[model samples]
Target: MKKIRKSKTEQLNFGNYSFEVIKKKIKNIYFRVYPSKGKIIVSAPFSIDSETLNKAILSKSDWLNKQVKKAAIAKPEPVKTYITGEKLLFKGEIYSLYVDYRHTGPRVAKTFDKVIHLKVKPGTDFPQREKIIISWYRKELKRSIGMYIDKWQPRIGVTVNEFNVRKMKTRWGSCNVNAKRIWLNLALIKCAEKFLEYVIVHEMIHLLERKHNARFKSLMDRFIPDWKRLKKELNRFSL
Candidate 1:
C-alpha cells in the first residue's frame, strides 16, 4: 500500500534553505532531510510558533547545507513515453532503449554494447510497457542485492534474515535491525555497483549503530571514505 504523505502546514526560509514546518499532533519536533534532492522537512507540535520553528531548523544548518548540496545536483527526469530511441539510466550509465515486439511476454535484457533490449508483446501500450520495465528492474535489483549482501554480511559482521526489493519514494533502502532484514529500493538498479555497495554497507552498519551519530559516520568513513560524494552522485538523476 502507498503511504499518504502528510500535508505541509507552513513553509519558512532559513539560511540557504526553504523548508516546510508541519504542525502535527505529535509531542516533539522532528527534522528530516529527504534523500531525494535533500528536501528539508520539520514536523513539530501544533503549539510551536514560527520563530521557534525557524530557530530549530536553523540550528541544523551545517547538516542542512550538505543536504542542499546533494539536492542541487539532482536532475529531474522528464515524462517518459517508453518509446524507441529513449534513454534509460542503469548502473550509473545511460543506455539507449530498443523496443521490440516479437515476444509472447515482455522481457528486458542489456547488451555489452550498452543497449537495453526490451522485447514485449506486439503493440503494447504505455502502461504495459512501463510495467514490463519496472518488473525487469525489480528482478535485476533483487539478484544484484543478493550478491551484495552475501559479500558484505561477512565483512560487516552481520547476519541478514531476509532482504526485500520494492519501490520506496523517499529512501534507497531501509533496515529492520531487530529482524535482521533489509529492504532496498527498486530504483537502485539504476545506480553504479560502487554506489550500490555504499548503500548496502550503510544499511548493514545500521545493524551495528541504530542512529546516524558519531559512531555511524565513523563506520561509514572506515568502510567507504567517499560515501558522501557517491551519495550526491547517486541522487544526481531523479528516478
Candidate 2:
C-alpha cells in the first residue's frame, strides 16, 4: 500500500487546531487517514498554504490523532445509494416510494402504510422531478419541525420561540439564540431517522450553548452518543 505523505513546506503548531482558509460548498472540513494509519487528514481548500496549515494541525496533533483513530474504529458508512424503488429514511424509519405518472404535475402524497407516493407526469425532466420531490421535502420538514421542537424542548430545558424551514447551503440547521428561534434545512428530510434527530438535537442544544465549544459537545454527547457517526453518515447523502 502507498504511504500518505504530508507537504514539507507546511508548518506545524499546537493547541485546539483548525485551518482558517479552507471553504467548500460543504461548510465543514473532513479529516481522514487511509486504512486507519498515518497523520491526521485535513480536507480543505487546495489553495491553503501547506506551511501554515501544517503548523495548526501539529498544534492539536494529540486531539486530531485521537479523532482519526476513533474514525477508524467507527462503524462503516451507511449505504445511501440513490436508486429507483429504494426506500428513504424519515424521522427514524424507512419510507418507501412508489413512483407513478397519473398526475398532471408532480405531487407527493402519503400512503396508508407510511410510504411517500410521488406522482409525476410521464416523461418529466430531471429538474421537474427534483423540484416536485424537493417541494414535498419542504412540506414534510414544516410538518415535522413542530413535533421535534416540542419533544426536545423539555429534554434540553429550552423553549424556542419560533422556527422555520428553508434550503440552507452550509448547515443542516441553525439557531438564533437572541430570538429563541431555529431554522432547519429542508434537505434533512432525506436523511436517516437518527441523522434527523441529531440535527434537531444539535440545534436545540444551541439554545443552551451558543457556540460549538466544549459545553456544546458535552451536551451533544450526553444526548446523542453516536452523533459523530451520524454526522459522517449524513455527509454521504446528496443535499
Candidate 3:
C-alpha cells in the first residue's frame, strides 16, 4: 500500500563523488547527505533521464564536497556554560536564554513567545546548573519519545523493553536489537521533534531489520519517505 517506492538504481561518477541515483515513483528529486560516512544518495522520479540527474549533481558538487569534508573532520560539541544570552533549540525552534537568580529554586520553562526561562539560586556553580538543565532536558525528551513510541510501536510491530536517554558523543540513537532497548542521545532535546521521531522510528525499525541494508532502506522508505531529509536535519547539530 505504499504510494512511493524505489524502482531501480544507477551508479555514476559525477564531479568528485561517485554516488547512486535511485529511480523511484516519487514526485520530486531528493538528495541525502550522510555525516558519519560522508555518503550521498539521490532519489529521483522514474521518468527522469540520466543527463538531468548528472546536471543536478554537478550543480551541487561544491556544497556536497564541503559536507563530506565536514563529516570527515566532524568535531564534538563543547560543554555548555548555560549563561544568559546563550540560545537553546527545541522542536526545531530557537529560544533565547534568560537566567534569573532571584528565586530560591532552579526552574526551566519555554515561554509562548519563544524564550527559555532559567531560574536558579544565586551562587549556583556550573555543575549544579548543568544538573538542573540536563534534568529538564531528559524529562522533556522522554515525554516526546514516549509519544513517538506509542505512535510507532504498533505500526512497526515492535516493542521497546527499555528506553534510555544519555549523553552520547558519536551517535544520535542506538538500538539493542537483541534486548529491544533503544538509547537516544541526550543532545536530541536540542533538535527538532520531527528528527526525534525519525530517530525513534529508525531505532524501532531495527527490530525488524538488524542491518542498514537494502531491506532497511526499503522499510524506511515505506514508513517515512522523508527520513533522509530528517536525518540531515538531525545531524545539523554538532556532536
Candidate 4:
C-alpha cells in the first residue's frame, strides 16, 4: 500500500479512543477521523497552525476512535484472478470455469455438468478472455430483464417505460425518473434470482420515490422482507 503523507500544516493528535487529524483547507479547518478502523486521516489547508489542528482532532477524540475501529473492522473484497478451473458464483451456486483455446473468436458455452466453458485462442490474454465472458453475460442479462419486468410491473403497481442492461462500476441499478427508464448491471446475473428481483424492485420503486428515504425502505419491506440479507449475499459475489 502507498503511504499517506501528512500535510505540511497538519498535526496528528493521539487519544485513548481513536486516531485523528486536524487539516486546514482553503476554505476551512476540519478534523477528520476514520473511527471504525482506528485510522485517522486529516486534511487541512496550508495556512492552519499545528496547535489549532491538534486541538480540533483531540476534541473529537471519542467519535474519531469509534470511526477508526469501525473502519478497521471493515474488510475489503479480495482481488480475484481469472484462471481456469476457478469456482465462480452464478445464481447462488458455485460453478467451475473451464478455459480452452480455439481458432475462432471468444465463445462461452455451457456444459451439461453446469460448467462455463470459455474458448479463446491459445495466446489470448486475460483481458480478452474477460471481455468475451462479460459480453456473454450482458447478452444473457438482457434476455432475462424483460421477463422480470413483465412479472413485477403489475405486482408493484408501477410501469417502467424503458430499461437497458450494461456493465456498471458503482451501482447495480439506476433509474431515470424524467424518462421513466431504468438501467441494470450485467454483473447482477451472477447473483441469485431473488437478489436480482430486489434490484429490479429497487429501481422500480425509484419511479415512485426518487431517493432512498423512509418511503423507499417501506416500499421495499412491503414487497421483499428479506432484502437486507439478500443484498449482503449479493455483495459477497464478484461483480
lDDT by residue for model 1 over 13-90, one digit each (tens)? 777777777877788888777755446788898777778877877787787776554443355555777888887777
Candidate 2 vs candidate 4: the lDDT winner is 4
Assess every candidate by TM-score: 0.66, 0.53, 0.66, 0.59
Off by over 4 Å in 3: 1-79
List the candidate numbers ranked by TM-score, top first.
1, 3, 4, 2
Relative to the true structure, how large is the alpha-carbon lDDT of every model?
0.81, 0.67, 0.83, 0.71
> Which one is best on lDDT?
3
Give the lowest summed-lDDT range of ten residues in model 4: 69-78
Across 116-177, the per-residue lDDT of candidate 3 in tens digits comes to 88899899888887788889989999999999999998998999999989999899999999
Q: Each candidate: how many clashes?
A: 0, 11, 1, 25
TM-score of 4: 0.59
Worst 10 residues of 3 by lDDT: 69-78
The model with the greater lDDT, 3 or 4, is: 3
Q: Write the per-residue lDDT of candidate 2 for residues 67-154, one digit (tens) a residue.
A: 5444433324345332357565554345776777774756787766868777877877667766777777777877777877788889
lDDT of 2: 0.67
Write model 4 residue lDDT over 130-236, tens digit each, in one string.
Answer: 77877887787777788898998998889999999887877889999999899998777776677788899889988889988999989989988988887775564
lDDT of 3 at 89: 65
